[model samples]
Structures are given as structure tokens and as C-alpha cells.
Target: MSRTVAWTPEATETFDIIVELIETKWGFASAQKFVRTANQTILTLASHPEMFVTVKGQTIRRAFITKQTSLFYEITEQQIILLYFWDNRQEPIL
Candidate 1:
């Protein structure tokens, strides 16, 4: 069975920040596209939780696509919480 996914408040806040940043740097359409790609990536994780590796005993995963930003997330028993989005041009914080 597929695992359920729920966003933490922190995840929601990060999503909002990403949307705002995309809108500011690109456009509304680009922000919408990012949201669509993010949702698809999260669902992919839910369907294949094993694809993620553990970090400090937590299941932390990243989705990377060339010419696009990467998404960081953590998987728990009850939820897939997004941590942050990192532009490919910058280094990730962890």
C-alpha cells in the first residue's frame, strides 16, 4: 500500500517561501509549475519510500533535476515533510 503524506507547518512555510521566491524571480506561471513539480515529486516518494536513504536515523531524500531546483524532504511513518528547496546554483545547507 502507498504511504500517506502530510505536510508539517514548517513544510508549508517552506513551500510558501518557495512560491514567493519563484514568483519574484520568474513569474506566476513558473511558480505554478514549481508547485506542480513539487507535488509530483512528493507523490513519487510516497509510492516508493525505499528510494530514500536515512539521515541521522531519519529518512531524508532529495529529488534533483537538471536545469531545475532540487527538493529536500523527510519521510516518517505518517507523513512526508518537505524541508526545503535549493537552487542548483547554490550549495545545500544539509
Candidate 2:
């Protein structure tokens, strides 16, 4: 069965911040594209939670939504819980 996906408060906040930053630095169109891409990626994760590589020695897995943005999530038996949206240009959080 396909697992559901859930976003934590931190994930939601960071996602909004990243979208706003994209709109400011790029354009509204780019921001929209990012949203669509993120949605598609989330759908993919629902069915294939292990598609992305897990963080070494960690339970979290990371998926690159774009060249500049990545998503961190943890897979559970019933759901994939989103942890954060990270800016790849910045220092690694994990």
C-alpha cells in the first residue's frame, strides 16, 4: 500500500519561506513550478518512500526538489513525515 505524507510545522514553515524566496529571487512562474514539482515529488514518495537515499546512519531520507532545494523526510510504517525543506546552497543541517 502507498503510505501517506505529512508535513511537520517546521517543514511547512520552511516550505513557505523557500517558495517566497524563490518568488523574490526568481519569479512567480518559477515559484509555481517549484510547488508543482514538490507536489509530484510528494506523490512519488507516497508510493516509493525509499526511492531517495537515506542519510548516513540516520532514519531520514533526502530528496532534491530542485537544484537549490531539498526535502528531508522520515519514513514510518504508515506515513512519510516531512522534516524540513533545506536550501542546498547553505550548510548541511544533518
Candidate 3:
């Protein structure tokens, strides 16, 4: 069976920010495209959770949403819990 996908609050907020940025920078159509692409990519995890290599740790995996962003998630037996949505274009907050 395919695992369910759940987005954390942080991930949802990050997604909102990116979509808003795209809408403001490009247009609603671009933002819709971005969301559709991202959702399709995210769904790929349900059937193949191990597609992406673990980046942050042994349990966490990342899947690219766009050229500049990726979604980080952890896989359990029944679901994939989305942890964060990272935007690569921004400066590292260090």
C-alpha cells in the first residue's frame, strides 16, 4: 500500500511563502504550475519513499520541488511526514 503524506506546519508555511513569492514575482498561472509540479513530485514519495538519498540524517530524505526548493520528509511505515521546505536561493541563516 502507498504511504500517506503529511505536511508539517513549518513545511506548509514555507510552501505558502514560496507560492506567494511565485505569484507576486511571476503570476497566478506560474504559481499554479509550481504547485502542481510540486504536488506531483511529492506524491511520487508515496509509492517510492526511498527515491531520494537521506541528506540531513539517516531518516530524513529530500525531494526537489523546483530548481530552487526541496521538500524534506521522514518516512514511517504508514506515512511520510514532511518536515521542511527549503529554498536554495536564500542565504543560509547562520
- In model 1, which range of ten residues has the least summed lDDT? 58-67
Residue range 1-94, candidate 2, lDDT tens digits: 7998999999999999999999999999999999999999999999999999999879999999999999999999999999999999999878
lDDT of 2: 0.95
Ranking by lDDT: 2, 3, 1
TM-score of each: 0.73, 0.97, 0.91
- Per-residue accuracy of model 1 over 19-88 as CA lDDT, tens digit each: 8988999999999988888778778878886675655564677765226677667767766666666676
73: Cα error in model 2, Å? 0.2
The 0-to-1 C-alpha lDDT of every candidate, in the order given, reads: 0.72, 0.95, 0.88
Question: What is candidate 1's local distance difference test score?
Answer: 0.72
Per-residue accuracy of model 3 over 1-94 as CA lDDT, tens digit each: 6899998999899999999999999999999999999899888998899999887566888888888888889999999999888888877432
**Which regions of candidate 3 are displaced past 4 Å?**
92-94
lDDT: which is higher, 2 or 3? 2
Query: Which model, 1 or 2, shows the larger TM-score?
Result: 2
Segments of candidate 2 deviating more than 4 angstroms: none
